[model samples]
Target chain A: MLGRLNHIAIAVPDLAAASATYRNTLGTRPTAPQVLPEHGVTVVFIDVGNTKIELLEPLGADSPIAAFLAKNPSGGMHHVCYEVANIIAARDHLKSEGARILGDGEPKIGAHGKPVLFLHPKDFNGTLIELEQE
Target chain B: MLGRLNHIAIAVPDLAAASATYRNTLGTRPTAPQVLPEHGVTVVFIDVGNTKIELLEPLGADSPIAAFLAKNPSGGMHHVCYEVANIIAARDHLKSEGARILGDGEPKIGAHGKPVLFLHPKDFNGTLIELEQE
Candidate 1:
C-alpha cells in the first residue's frame, strides 16, 4: 500500500530553467542537481518541508525523458512517487491484484538510494506511479 | 510557497471500478463520490494519511475529463493540487513569475470549498497545477 506522498516528478526539457522558476519566483531553493546515470535523468529536488517537487531532465539521448520530450516538446508531470513501508510487500500485493510493475519487476536503487519500483502507467490510469520504500 | 501536497488527481473512465482498485486491490478506502457540476467532475478521495488520491470522472459529456479520456481511453493523472497559505499571494507571485492562471485570472471555489486557481500547463512544463489556499 502507499504511504505518504513523497514527491511529484516533472519531466522538464530544461532543468536549470525549471529550477530557476522555483528559486526566483516560487521562493523555494532547489537541491543541487544529482545525476542518476542508471535512470538517465538529472534530478533536482525543491523542498517544501512536507513534500518535494522533483525536476527531471534527460541525462542522455537514450533517456526516457528525452523520448517524452520528443512527443511533448514542452515538459510535463511524469510521475508521482509515494512512500511505502515495504516495497517488496507492496510490489507483491500489486502484482497479485494484476497491477503491472515496470523494469523487470524488480526494485532498483533510486534517487534517494532506496529501493524503488515503477508501476505501469496503464495499470494506474496512464499515470506512471512510483513506489519508494521508506 | 506550497505547503503539503493536498492531493494528486487521477482522471478515470469508471469511478466505481477505479474506486474498487483502490479499495479492494490497493487496500485503501475511497470516500464517497462528490459531484461538482461547476467543474463537471465527480470525485472521490482516497485518504493516505498525509495526503489523498483524488479520482475524477467526467460529470457530463462536456466535462474536461471526457476530452482527456477521448485522447487517453484508459484515463490518466489529470492534475495535482498543492496547498498554499494564501491563494491571492500565491496567485500574484505565480503571475509575476510569468505563470498563466487558468479561468478568469481569479481564484474559484474548488472541490474542497476553498479558493483554488489553476496554473496553465505551458508555464509549469505542461503540468496542470492547482494551488488551493489552506
Candidate 2:
C-alpha cells in the first residue's frame, strides 16, 4: 500500500525560474539541484513540510521533459509519487490491474537514490506516476 | 503560504467502482460520498496519511470532469491542492504573475465547508488547480 506523498513533480522550461517562483511564493528556496543523465533532466527540490516540490528541466531537446514542455509551455504539475513499502509487490499488483509499467523489469535508482519505478501515462490516464521505496 | 495537502483529485468514471478499487487496494473504505451542485459532480475521499485521495465522478455531460474522463477513461491523477493561509491574497498574487483565474470574483464555499477558488488550466499547462483556505 501507499504511505505518505513522496513528492509532486513539476515540469518547467527553466528550473531556476521555477525554483525562484516557488521560493518567492512559498517563502523558501529549493535544495541543491541535481542532474540525472539517464533521465536527461535536472531537478531541484523545495521542502514543503513532510512533502517536497520537485522542479524538473530538460537538459536538451531530446529530453522527454522537452517534449512535455512543448505541449504545455506554461509548465504544470507532472506526476505524483507515493511512498510504498514493497515496490515489487506494488508494481506487480498494479500491473495485474492492467497498469503499464514504463521501465523493463526491476526498479531503478532515482534522483533521490531510492528504488523507483514509473507507471506509463497510457495506463494512468494522461499523468505519469512514480512509485518509490526507500 | 501553503498549509498541507488538502486533497488529491483523481478523475474516474464509475465512482463506486473506483472507490471499491481503492478500498481493496488500500485496505479501507472511502469517506461518505457527496455531490456538489455547483461543481456538477460527486466526490469520495479516501484517507491516506495526513492527506486524502478524492475520487471525482461527473454528474452529467456538461461537467468539466466529464470532458477529462472522456479523453482518459482508464482513470488518472488530477489536480493537487495545497492548503493556503489566505485564499484572496494567494489568488491575487497568482493573478499578478499572469496566472488566469477560472471562477468569478470571491472564493466560494466548497463541499468541505471551506472557502475555495480555482486557477485556470492555461497558467499551469494542462492541470486544473483549486486553492482552498479554511
Candidate 3:
C-alpha cells in the first residue's frame, strides 16, 4: 500500500541540463545533486509542494539508469517512489500479494538518509516503484 | 508552482480489474468511479495518504488512453497531476518556457469539478502531465 508520494524519478541524459530546464520552467531550483554509488546514478531533488521531483542521470554504462535510457531512447520518467510508514511491513505485505521485492530483507539507506526498497517492475506492470520509510 | 500531488495516473487495460487488484493488495477501496466524457475514459481513485493513485481505462478506440495503451501494451504509469493554486498562471508560465498546452484556453471541469488542463508530452520528455486547480 502507498502512504504518500515521496518523489517521482525522471531519467535524463544530463542532470544539470534537466535540472536547469525544470527550474526555469517551474520557477524552482533543485536542492542539490547527490550521487548514489550503489545505484550508479546521481539525483537532484526539486521540491514540488508536498512532493518532490527527482532528476536522475546515469553515471556510466553499467548504471541501471543507462540501461533504462537505452531501452527508452528518448528518455522519460523512470520510476515513482511511495512513502510508507514501515518499510518492512509494506515489503512483506506486497510480497505476500505476489509482488516481488527487488531488495531482499532490510531496506538500504538512500538519499536523504531514508530507508528504501525497490519493487520489481514485473510485479507492477512494468513500472519501477520504490518504497521509502521515514 | 505546485500545491500538491492530486493524483498519479496509471494507464491500465481494465478499470474494474485493476481497481480490484489494487484494492486487494493495498487493503483499501477506491473512492468511486468517475467518467470524463471529454477525456474519453473512466477513472478510479485510490487514495494514498496525501496523494492519489488514479487507474485509467480507455472508454473507446478514440480515447487517448487507448492509443497510449496500444504502445505500452504491458501497461505502466502514465501522467503525474500537480495541484496548483491558479491553473491559468501555471499554464501560462509553462507555455512561456516553450511547453505546449494540449488543451485550449479556460480549464475544463474534470471528474470532481476540479478545473484541469493538460500539457503536451513533448515538453516533458514523453510524460503526459495534468495541472489541476481546485
Candidate 4:
C-alpha cells in the first residue's frame, strides 16, 4: 500500500533558523516559506534527492503544530508521510487491521494538495504517519 | 552536501511489535531483524521505494537509544540520515558553519557499515542528523 516515502515533517520553533540550518549547514536549498492558513503552518520544503524535508512553523494560535512546538520548543521530527496508490483502500485495510485513524477517520486535503489521513501514533510505533494519495 | 536521505531511524521499545505494525498495518514488507552489537541496536528496514525506515531497538543496557526510549517509552523518531559524498569534508564544512558534531567528532562505522557522524540536535532544530559517506 505504501509507495515512496513522501516527506519527513519537522516542527520547528523558528522556521527561518531551521531553513537556514538546512541551507547553510547541510548545503541543501530550501524553498521559500509558504503559509498554509488551513493547515496553520508556514512550511519550507528542502529537496533531498529522493525525498523532502518539510520545515513547519505554527502559523497561528490554533495551529496543529503549536502544541508540538510547545512540547518540543527547539523543534523535532513531527511526522513521516508515505505515498499510496489508493488512500480509501489503504484506510480501509488499515482499519480492518485494527490500526487507528486520526481525526474523524476522513482524508483531508493535505499540505501538498493531496488527499491524506493521519494514523494514531500509538498504533505506529509512536510515529505519526501520514498516508498521502499519489 | 546532503544527498538522498539514507533512512529515517525510529527507536522502538518493542522491535517485534513495531515490525509487525509496519508489515501488517502499513502493508509493507520489513526485512528480518539484524542485530548490530557495535551500534547496540537490533534493526529492521522497511523499504518505502525511495528510502528506508529503520526500526531500531536497544540491544543492550548501554545502547545509545536506551536513554531515548527511557524518555519516550513508546519510542519515537531517533534520527534522520542523509548521504554525503565525503564525510570528512562534510564534517569540516559543518564545523566551519558552527554545527556541533556529536561524540568525538569523528566519523564512525554506522549500522549500514558506512562512515557516519551525528550532528548535535541543538545545532539542527532539535533533530538529530546523521551524515553517512556514500
Candidate 5:
C-alpha cells in the first residue's frame, strides 16, 4: 500500500529560474541540478521538511517532460510519487482494480535508485502517479 | 520560511470516484468529503503518513477550480501547499524577490482553517503554490 508521500515532481521549462524561485522566493535551499540521462531530465531537489519538491527540466529532445513543457511552456506539476512497501504486490492490486500501469507494467529503477512504476493518468483522475518502493 | 509540505491538492472532476480510487486502488483510507463553500470546493483528505493528498472537487459555478477542470477536464494536480512559520514575513520576502502573490495580497482562511495565500503560477514555473501559516 501507499506509505509516505515521497516527492512532488514539477516539470519546469527553465530549471535555473525554478530553482532560484524556490531558493530566493520560497527561502528554501534547492540542491544543484543533476542530470539523469536515462530519465532525460535535469533535476534539482528542494527539501521541504517532510517531503521533497523536484524541479525537472528536459534534458534531451526525447525527454519524458519535453512534451509536458511544450503543452505548459511555463511548467507545471508533473507527477506525485508515493512510497509503497511492496511494489509488485501494489501493482497487482492496482491491476486487479482495473487501474492501468504505465510502461510495460514493470517497475523501473527510478530517480532515487528505487524500484518505481508510473500509473496511467487517466486511471488516476488525470494526475500522473509514481509509486516508489520504500 | 517554508517548513513542511502541508499537502498536495488535486482537483478532480468526480470527487466520489477520485476518493474511491485512492481508498480502494491505492489502499489508503480517505476521510469523508467536506464541502467548503467559501473556498468553492468539496475536499477529501488522504493521509500519506508524512503529509496529506487533498482531493478537491468544484463545489459551485463560481468554484476557483472550475476553470482548471475545464482546461484539464478529467482533473489534475492543482497546487502544492507548504507550511510557513510566519506568513506575513513569508509574503514580504516573496514580494521583495519579485514573486507575484495571488488575490488581494492578504492571507485568507484556507481549507484547514489556517491563514493561506496563493502565489502566481507564472512566477513559479506554472505551478500554483499555496503557503499556509504554521
Candidate 6:
C-alpha cells in the first residue's frame, strides 16, 4: 500500500540551526518553518528533488519530540513517512494484520495538509513509521 | 544535488525476524538478504514502490549498527540514503561547505554496486546520512 518515500523526519534540538544547515549550508532552499500546534512541532521541509527531509522541533514540553530529545539530547531520526494510495485502507489493512496505529487510531491533518497516521515503533522494528495519504 | 530518496535504513537486532515482519506481516516482499563483509552488515531491501526500506543487521561485533544497537537495544533507524546525480561533485561541494564526510572522505562501493559515502551524524543533526551515485 506504500507508494513512494515521502519524507524522513528528524527531531532536532535546535530548529533554526538545523534549518540553516539545510538551507544556507547545504543549499537546499528549504521551505519556511511552520508551527503545527496540533502536532506540537515546528517543522521545515528541505526539498530533495523527488522527496523531502523534514526537520522537526518540539513546540512544547509535552510534545513527543521533546521527550525524544530529552533522551537523545542532540536529537535524531524520528520517523519515516511513505505515501499511500488511501490512508484509511492502508490503516485498516495494517490493523487487520495486528499492526498498532498510534494515537487514537485515526488520521490527523499533517504538515502537508494531508491525512497522516503514525504506527507504533514496536511493530516496526523500533522505527516509527508514518503513512501519509498520497 | 540530491535526487530521490533511495532508501531509509533501519538497524535490527535480528535480520531474519525483521525480514519476516516486513515480508509475512506487512506483506511487502523483500529482496534476498546480502551480507557485506566490508561494512560488517547483512541487509535486505523491501520494495515500497518508488523507494526501498533497507533492513540492516550487524555481521560482526564491530559493525556500526552494533554500536547503535548497544545504545538503543531494540535497534532503530540507522541512516538515510539519497541519490545524487554525480556523487563526486556532491562530495566536493559538501566538503567545501565544511560538512564532515565519514571515514577517510572517500566513496566506497555499496550494496547496490554504486559509489556511496557516509556523512557524520554530527554534521546532519545527529542523523547519519548516506549519498549514493545515481
Best by lDDT: 4
Fill in the DockQ of model 6.
0.63
Ranking of predictions according to lDDT: 4, 5, 1, 6, 3, 2
Candidate 5 C-alpha error for residue A2, in Å:
1.1
DockQ (C-alpha based) per candidate is 0.71, 0.41, 0.60, 0.89, 0.91, 0.63
lDDT (0-100) at residue A90 of candidate 5?
Answer: 96
Off by over 4 Å in 4: none
Arranged by DockQ with the best first, the candidates are 5, 4, 1, 6, 3, 2
DockQ of candidate 4 against the true complex: 0.89
Candidate 5 vs candidate 6: the TM-score winner is 5
Best by DockQ: 5
Question: Residue A132 of candidate 2: its Cα lDDT?
Answer: 92
Q: Provide all candidates' interface root-mean-square deviations.
A: 1.5, 3.2, 2.0, 0.7, 0.8, 1.8
Ranked candidates, highest TM-score first: 4, 5, 1, 6, 3, 2
lDDT of 2 by residue, A1-134 (tens): 76777888888887776677666644456877798888788999877566877888988557767877887788877788878889999888886776678859589887788999887766544557788994
lDDT of each: 0.86, 0.76, 0.79, 0.93, 0.93, 0.86
Model 1, B7-102: lDDT tens digits are 889999999988998887677889899998988999999988777889999997689678878888898878888889999999898888787888
Best by TM-score: 4
> Residue pairs in steric clash, candidate 3?
none
lDDT of 4 by residue, A1-134 (tens): 88999999999988898888889989999999999999999999999999999999999889998888888899999999999999999999999999899999999999889999999999877899999999
Going through the candidates in order, state the TM-score of chain A alone for each one.
0.94, 0.89, 0.88, 0.98, 0.98, 0.92
Task: List model 6 lDDT by residue over B35-129, tens digit each.
Answer: 89888899998888777889999997688788888887778998888888888898899998899999898899988899999998888888888
The pairs that clash in candidate 2 are none
What is candidate 6's TM-score against the reference?
Answer: 0.92
- Candidate 1 clashing pairs, residues 3+ apart or interchain: none
After superposition, the stretches of candidate 5 with alpha carbons farther than 4 Å from their true spots are none
Off by over 4 Å in 6: none
